[model samples]
Target: MIKLANYTQGQWQEGTGPGTTLYDPVLGTALASVDAGGLDMAACYDWARTQGGTALRALSYAERAALLKQIGQVLQDNRDKYYDISLQNSGTVQNDTAVDVDGAIYTLSYYAKLGGKLPAHVHLEGESQGLARDNAFASQHIEVPARGVALLINAFNFPSWGLWEKAAPALLSGVPIVVKPASATAWLTHEMVKDVIEANILPAGALSIVCGRPEGLLDALNALDMVSFTGSADTAASLRGHRRIQHDGVRFNAETDSVNSALLGPDDSDAAADLLVREVVRELTIKSGQKCTAIRRIFVPESRYEAIAGAIAAKLKTITVGDPRKPEVRMGSLVSRQQHEAILAGIAQLSHHCEILFNGSTEITIQAEAGSACVAPMLFGAKDPDTNPLVHQVEVFGPVATLMPYRDTEHAFELVRRGMGSLVASVYSEDPQFMAQAAIRLAESHGRVHLVNTEVAKVQTGHGNAMPQSNHGGPGRAGGGEELGGLRALKFYHRTAAIQASPDILNRLIQNAE
Candidate 1:
């Protein structure tokens, strides 16, 4: 079996404790073993703060962007090898794996674009007063790199893109990175990290990885350190409120799974309905509905409840469940047995609040099949929104969606808002006026809104996933944190300080560059 090791301090380090066995979902056989026992968290932090940060700061913004482009090119050169490893990580098809593998490279490429487009200098100038007392002060703003380490805690789904989104900005900002990928599919991330090391794109100690758990890792952080996490609200809360993190004033940013919803416009034609069905089905089956941004609740007119579910259910039925490497397969298995159990448990919680409409329960009959865990599409019908608030409160992280109906457009927006806060909400409409009204009303409650219809539907990223260019988080129970909004991510990596003084003092400070 292939053994997984941690990449730290410019070398691969062996684990000190028990190892976790990695497997293939299609074959149910051992592929590798990852050891993550006795990692030196303190030393890891020291290396990033010193060696990593120093090298990155030496380069200018344009120079840094150039390095990122080189890294992207290197990733493209070895894309096939990364895709090969992605196939075994519960990805049921090549398209699914390619999105994760290539999407990461694209994210870095986008960062290079951002660096070239954004202004290098920000000038804060005071307005000139009347005649002889024409006193004006000039303050030049310089976008400098954060002089510390960045700690990234990513989710299991989209492991490659999840970590790459954060790494691109951190490195570009002249900060080093120490990543902690989700344990479920750390091997794939490990492989990608190996390529990053071999390419010599990043300086030694600029990027590091710890495959498994690193206990007491946060305690060693300093004021300049940053923490970016993407996961569930419960886990986010525990990490965001850590004793050491709070005491040391370490920055923390989180993107938690929320009750993301989608809507069908009032003037939507039959074509709109058909488009909605396709989008919904894609959200439910892609990554087995394991995405944090997956549509958990769907809002529609009371008259079209059965029609929407029936159309979507048919598409779900056609999805093939087998090895992700097979070209014929459209959907893949969940990441692991433990994740399968968690999704089922979440489904049970929803069942208590809503009735099952379409049960996608089936056993795998393909080769190397292990029937120990299997989940097909599950559609829940929540007829009444007021009867139980739990329907909007809980989420079944699988190929499932709860269909909720409303009397009119106003009622639809209200029901959508009742989910507390969400990461995203989408409305499909051919009418521009209706789309405008719905988007304006729902925009406050959701971090993202896809005002999609036949016009932009062809290129839509769909309703269930967040791209690296946009913010992928929400407010309230949806964790009320943000991540991946271009350079907004850098806000979490560095500390912002405001200095109040005369122009001469500021000039002296800038001129005395130590």
Candidate 2:
């Protein structure tokens, strides 16, 4: 089998030590072996700072943006190759793979176009403010590149989109990047990076990939460096407490998993009921419910609990679980055997507090061979979710969700808050007042909330989809950071400084002297 290589110091080097084998989730066939034992940690950082940082910082925003546009075109022209690889490694159908491949291309192009409109200099000057009573002294905030490398630790669920989304802003801000993709799905990311490097679209060291264990990378960071992570909360906590991070004052941004929820209001119209059922099922089955923004908890009015549950259960029964390569399959296997077993354990724990409304099954019939890691969709309903701590706190991280009944609008708000904080939430209501009130209440705990009604339901983007134009992170358990909110994401890689001086001095410093 081929071994995955690490791209560091502008070269591809094979790993040392015994490596772990990666398998195809749909075929149970070995794909590659990954290890990072032979790589030099300090040299990698030094190369990025000296070689990569110098090349990127020398270019103006417009010049860098043009480079990004060329890269985007190259990736778009070869998207089919990425889709084929994703189907084998990720166990996703064409549609699911498009979410990663197409999403990445769009983000790169968006940043390319936006960067041209910005100022040529690396620093951006805010509106000047007069400080003295006679308006003699003025101050302004200026944003400039941090002049350090960005370390990106990505999740396995989106190998392509995850890397590009973070890389776009970092490159746009004139900062280089070192990517550490999750080991399981690193092949796709590795392939994409290889394409970019071969095309010579980026500077020699501007972008690099470390496919295996990120053993000593963290120790090499300094105070000026920035780290962005996406994974479990446990991993986030461990990284946040690293001694080097504290000593160097590295900027750390994390986006972790949370039990995101969706609310069904008291509206009993067929429009509301149909929209609610359709959206719930869609979120549960898409990407096998591995999305960080997927709905893990469902809150409904006491009177409509049974009706909503029945409607969702009926819709789920029609879905076919099998290998994504087969055209008839609606849902594919989990990413790997380990993830499949983890989801099974989570279901067992949740079953203690709730009754199984639709236990699709532990066994499944699939078009692929028997070794594939496939599991049926499972749905549990809790009569008194407000009292069940597990229902409110535990996240299955797969095709599973808990349905609970709420007393009223206040009760719904309380249940939603129990999630601590989430990346996204949804409310299905036709009543204008109820929708407005619920949105305000839920906004306190969620980064984004989707309000669906009869007129907008047909065109609405579902709850699990994170757009490039909106902020994707949330507060509390979801990780207190913001990402991809237009130009806001670029600020993470830049530092802001306030400059106070006379009007003439300020004008000269800003390079706008009249």
Candidate 3:
């Protein structure tokens, strides 16, 4: 079997130790060994900052954007190979794989095009503010590249999209990146990076990857470095409190696990009911509910609880689970056997507070081998969500959700807030007045709220889709970081400085001063 290697210092190096074997999620067979032993983390950072950072910083925004566009085009041409790898490792169907592979290319291309419209150098903040009574002195803010490297620690669910999304913004800001993908699904990420490097898509040190254990990497970082992580809450908390982040002042941003909720308004119209049911089902089954933004707590009007729950359960039954290579399988396996077991454990904990509305069996009839990592979709109904703390606290990061009934619109809002904070939420209502009222309350807790109605329902991007142009992070338990809101993401890699001086001096300092 092939061994996954690390790309650093302008060369690919194999791990020194005997690494752990990676398994094909669908077939339960060993695919490759992953290791990052004996690699010099300090040298990797030095190379990226000197070689990669120098090359990227020397170019104008427009020129850098052109490079991104070229990379996107190359990846698009070779998408089929990525799809096959995604299937074998991630166990995702073609549609699911497209979300990762195609999404990555689109994000890069979008950023490339956006960069072309921007100025060549430091992004000026608002108009200069007059400081003196005579208006002779003024101050202005300008953002410049941080002159450091970005270390990206990604989750297992989205090996492609996760890397490219962060990379696009960092590169645009003239910062290089070093990615450490989750060990479980590093194969797909490794292959993608390998292709990009071979094609000369990026500068020699602009991008690098280290698979297997992330030992010595964190200690190698200094205050000048920035880290963006997406994973579990515990891991995010630990990383946040790391000595380097706490004392060294390294920038750290996290997108952690959240119990995102979806609320159905008190309106009993058939149109609203249909939209709610469809969205709930889609959020549950998409990528087998491995999404951080997937709906976990579902709130409905007390009178319409049975109708909504029954509709969702009936729709979920029609989904087929098996190997992603098969045409009939609508839902595929989890990322690996370890993830399967974790989901089962989460479901067991959730079952303590909520009754199983629809329990998919572990004994599944699948097209793949008998030991494939496949789990059935599970739905739990909490009779009193307010009383059942576990239903609100525990998150089963799979095709599982908890349904709860609310007494009124106010009660629905309260129940949704029980999740503390979330990445996204959806409010289904035909009445514009009710939606407007409920949305105001829901906005306090959710980063993004989907207002679903008959008119926009046809074109709506559903609940779990985090678009490139919008912000993707949330506050409180959701990690309290902002990402990908147009040019906002670029600010993460840049530092803002205020310049105060006389008009002529200010004019000389601020390029393109109005």
Task: Give candidate 3's whole-model lDDT.
Answer: 0.88
**Positional deviation of residue 153's Cα in model 1 after best superposition, in angstroms:** 0.7
lDDT of 3 by residue, 1-514 (tens): 7899899999999989878888898898888788998989999999999999999998888888998998898889889999988898889998889888998998998999999988887789988899998869899889988888999999999999999999899999999999999988888899988888999978889999999885678899878999999999899999988888988999999888899988887878898889888888888877888999999988988888788788888988888888887899999989999999999899888877778888777433556778888888888998888788888788889999989999987788888888888898898888999988877888888788889999898898879888888889887788887778779899999999898989888787765522
> Which residue ranges in model 1 land beyond 4 Å of their true spot?
118-143, 362-368, 499-514
Residue-level lDDT tens digits of model 2 in 247-346: 6789999999999988888876678878878888888888888888888998888898888888888988888887998899988878899998999999
The sequence of per-residue lDDT tens digits that candidate 1 reaches over residues 1-514 is 8878888877889888787787775566788777767887888889888898888877666677887898888788888877777777655467667667788898899889886664332212233222223333443444455787889998888788888888888887788999888877887788888877888888778999988776667887877788888888889889878876677778787778778888887774787888878888888878878887888888888888888878877777777776665566677788877777888898888887788877776422332266534467788888898677887888777787898888898888999998889889988878899989987998888888888888887788878656777877788877777777887765565444444456666666555432
Cα error, residue 497 of model 1, in Å, equals 3.2
Write the number of the candidate with greater TM-score, choosing between 1 and 2. 2
A best-first ranking of the candidates according to their lDDT comes to 3, 2, 1
The candidate, 2 or 3, that scores higher on lDDT is 3
Candidate 2 has what TM-score? 0.97
Error of 1 at 176 (Å): 0.4
Error of 2 at 455 (Å): 2.6
Estimate the TM-score of every prediction.
0.92, 0.97, 0.98
